[model samples]
Target: MERRKVDVAVIGTGTAGMVAYKAARKHTDNLVVIEGERYGTTCARVGCMPSKLLIAAAEVAHQVAGADMFGIHAEHVSIDGKAVMARVRRERDRFVGGVLETVDGFPAEHRLQGMARFIDDHRLMVDEKLEVEAGRIVIATGSRPNVPDFLQVAGDRLLVNDSVFELENLPDSVAVFGPGIIGLELGQALSRLGVRVRMFGVSGNLGGIRDDAIRQYALETFNQEFPLDPSAQVNRVERTDKGVRVTFTDKPKGKSPSEVSEDFDYLLAATGRRANVDHLDIQNTGIELDERGTPIFDHYTLRCSKDHIFIAGDANKDVPLLHEATDEGRIAGDNAGRYPDIRSGMRRAPLSVVFTDPQIAVMGLTLDQVKERCKGYYGVGEVSFEDQGRSRVIGKNRGLLKVYGERGSGLFLGAEMFGPAAEHIGHLLAWAAQKHMTVTEMLDMPFYHPMIEEGVRTALRDLNYKLNIDPQMIDRALECGPGA
Candidate 1:
């Protein structure tokens, strides 16, 4: 067997692994990055970039379909499914190629191609062909779509986000399971692109929002475009000659639930993702593990039980976002390269965004989290986009934005939003949360007239008043005009 030694070794060369390798290289020349699969980030390859490309197409289709509301008539708005899929694939390949180029630029000697499994705390075997012994190891193996065993009934008719982008043409209908981030984004996109989509979730969780009002608003808004059961009672899934068939109970509001069965070209499972650590043989490492067999590690340091072992990115499952993964990878790599001198890395305020239309976003502490931490020592402020100026002007006014504040300090704890331009608004709220800005302080920030951000200001104003810091407005002085 071939044997090698290194100062530090990083497993999986995705986003986290690449960042870890670069950070470790700064500390030692004897470091190598291992990749069992093809090079490229999940985002560029399948997750964020490619999904957004599909969403962009869907957005265009939706805009043309809705042009009549603006006194403009659009004729023959035919959607070419084949053409849409073609562009999605072509642009997806371009993104993946860019990531591949970056991987190619890495020093050849520092890259290893093989599946790595732990033999001991500081040793690993790569596909039984090469053995590696390192002073420190970092696991950044990323994650894959988690498919439930019951869905196996769909057999060849099953599809995941990874395989969806590979389609030659859009299907006539799709049954999307799990109304989480992936499900909502893909389900809505496909529906807007003229595909019949029925979405189901195990529980009533829409876009991962914690605030009840916002979640309800999102549920109502999405249901208007397509059938969405955030909480579904699915009976069975079977593969038919043509495709997959699903049986479930349809529970319409204020009516008795009825059992129904439907067939679709495919059953898309977007339930969630599982970290790619199970195959790593982590048991051999003698590290403390959680019930899920994932390593229990410090969030700030990204260190496993062993001083020389570290975990980061999706492998750690702390925060699965791309930016969070990048940050964790750097921390793990820096700590792994400089073992025995572990230091806590800076972690940013938590932020998450769902790219569905009228995008959904949650930043900093969620309402549930705040309640658990502060024990009802907080207040909530809300604004609905139904009457917001710019939103009404664009006919994109749907959903709500709720901001939270501490009762005593009037601190802007966090926010959950489902409204137009939420992606941009989420970033602004995240920045404010990170800066420890207060509710009144956020309101003090200039909000230009007739902008969507004005909605945010309105929420903060309500929060400021709720926090008992600002008087309840008797006069509508801030109102620039109707809808403004």
Candidate 2:
């Protein structure tokens, strides 16, 4: 076995691992990044970039077909499923190229192209050949799409986001196994592409929004485009001559069929993803794992059981979004390089978004998180897109925005909203929450006329009223001196 020693070793060349390497490089060049697969980050290769490309194509097809609603006689807008998919892949490859180029630029000796397993606290074996001794290690292996055991027999009929994006053509119809963000985004996009789609959610919630109003609106809107049943629980899956069939139990109340036997050209099992830690040989590192088999790491510092070891990204089973992964990678890398006298960073306010039409967004603390943290005394308010002028003018009046605040102090706590450009709205609120801004402080800022951002103004206004706050402070313009 070849023996090597490095100051730091990073496993997995995905988003988290790559960021860890880049951040660690600032401290020392004595580091190596090991890869078990392709080098492109998840955002560039499969998760974000390609999925958005496909969604854009589907959106175009949907818009052209609905042009008649705008008093314009739109002609037949036939969809070229094959061409659309091909274009997405072509563009997606370009994004992946940048990531590959960056990885390739690293010193040849600093990159290890193989799977790595922990041998001990500070040692790893790469590809059953190289034994790497490191002062510290950062594990950022990311995750893989979770599919139940029985569902795998369907073979090619079963699709995950990774395989789904690589398809040369779209299937005629699909039965989505989860109505979460990934499922809803692709499910709606597929429907807009003229694919017959039926979606099954684990529970009543939609796209991770626990806010009752936003979740309900998301369900109602997505249901208008495709069939989505929130009460569905898939129990069995089998292959058939026509396509794949799925059996679901606990049908929704007052539904047509007592049992659901859904048949479609494809079965998308997007329930969620599982951490990719099984192959890491974590037991050798003496790290304690959570009930989910993920390593128990410090939330603030991203440190594992051993001071020199850290876990980040989906492998930790916490925040799996691209941006969160980047932050975590930086934190882990910084600590891994510095070691013993470790420095830690504060966790960012939580922000998650779903890229569907009238997108769903959750910013900072959720309602439940807020209730627990604030003792259920937070003031709440909401606004409907149907009641908003911009949404009405744009002819996309279908969403809801709800904001929460501290009762007396009226501090902006967090929000869950589903509306046009909810991603941007989510960002705006997350920034405010991070700065510990109050409702009056948020309102002091300018809100452009006839825009989706006005929705924030409305929600904040309503929240102030709930707190019985005098509208004079918010309604008045900013001035250096009072009554000047």
Candidate 3:
């Protein structure tokens, strides 16, 4: 058995783990990154980059199919799923190859195709033979799709995000169970690709999002764009001779509980995801895990109870966005390299974005969080995608940007936007919220005229109106008025 020693041992080469490894390399030459699988993490192989590539391809196919609507005559427009899959694979390989090339030249050793298990507090058994001892360890073992015990996933018919991408043939119809970011993005993309897709979720709409106006807009846009029935609940999934059948029960309030079934060539089970911590064996190390089996880290420093072991990314549980994971990883890497008393300088609020057609982006607190924090707190905001001239020109008029602020202090609590450029602007609002910027500060900034940013100005104007400020104070000279 080979024995190795390092200053830091990073598990899982995903976005978060990779960032930690890169950061730690600068501080110490004794670093090792262990990946269990042959390929890179979800984002590189299945989750973000590949999924977005497929969505872009679908969008192009949609536009080409509708060329006749704009007086450009075209007939028998079709898509080759195989070619699209090939391109997706090629792009994925290119990305993974680039990362691997960079890591190869680094001073730290790369342990590809190896699993790490804790042999002791400071010792880890890699690939069942090699013994590695490190002073500090960082866990970034991403996440996996959460398939319920009741649902059985057979080879061809049932699929998760990972297996769905490797499909040789596209399903003519699909029943997606869950109204999450994954479900919405993949469901909408498949629908646009001519798949008869129906999404079923126990919740009324996208869960974890507090903005009702934006939720309503998403529901409306999904129904208008695809075959969506938000009022249905999936009872169970079963495989049959014809295909896979999804049994659904109708919502209450005089709605019949009839068992509605749909047969599809394939079914995508994107209900949700759970942290990939099953193999870590934290019980032996005296580390704590939450109810959902995720590591419990200090909210401020991201350190586990064991001072030398830090956890970040999906393994930490609460914030699961890619950007959040990267940020948390950086904090853990920086803190792990220093002494115990040195604080991890990372306390910024996270921003989340759902990559659907219109793209839903949210940051900081929602109105519910504000109300819970303060009993007599009042929220003021605006909701409108139609008010922006950019939305009209782009021909996508579906979404609303609402900014919530504390009434007395005029401090921005949070912001939610759903529109063509909502994702980009949502980050801007998140920065403002983190910096404690006021509405007046946002209004004073120079914005390009006739752009989607006009929606931000409109939202601030509406917030000012709700605050009962004099309209004259926000005239063209102040650039805080509705059209200013």
Model 3 misplaced stretches (Cα beyond 4 Å): 64-76, 108-113, 153-155, 205-207, 250-257, 468-484
TM-score of every model versus the real structure: 0.96, 0.94, 0.90
Comparing 2 with 3 on TM-score, the higher-scoring candidate is 2
Name the candidate, 2 or 3, with the larger lDDT value: 2
User: Candidate 2 — which residues are off by over 4 angstroms?
Assistant: 233-235, 248-256, 468-484
Ranking by lDDT: 1, 2, 3
lDDT of 3 by residue, 201-271 (tens): 76676834677767877777777776566556677678888678877775444775677767777778787
**What C-alpha lDDT do the candidate models reach, one value each?**
0.89, 0.85, 0.75
Candidate 3 lDDT at 35 equals: 80
> Ranking by TM-score, best first?
1, 2, 3
lDDT of 1 at 308: 86
lDDT of 1 by residue, 1-484 (tens): 9999999999999889999999999899998999998888999988999899999999999999999999999996899999999999899889999989988998899999999999999899999999999999999999999999989788878999989999999999999999999999999999999999999999788888887777888888899999999889999999999998899999988999999999999999999999999999998987999988899999999998887899999998788999999999999999988888999998998889999998999998888877876678789999999999999988988879998877766777788999899889999998988877777767778999889899998898888888854332212212221111
**Model 2 poorest 10 in a row by lDDT:** 475-484
TM-score of 3: 0.90
**Candidate 1 CA-lDDT value:** 0.89
Greater lDDT among 1 and 2 belongs to: 1
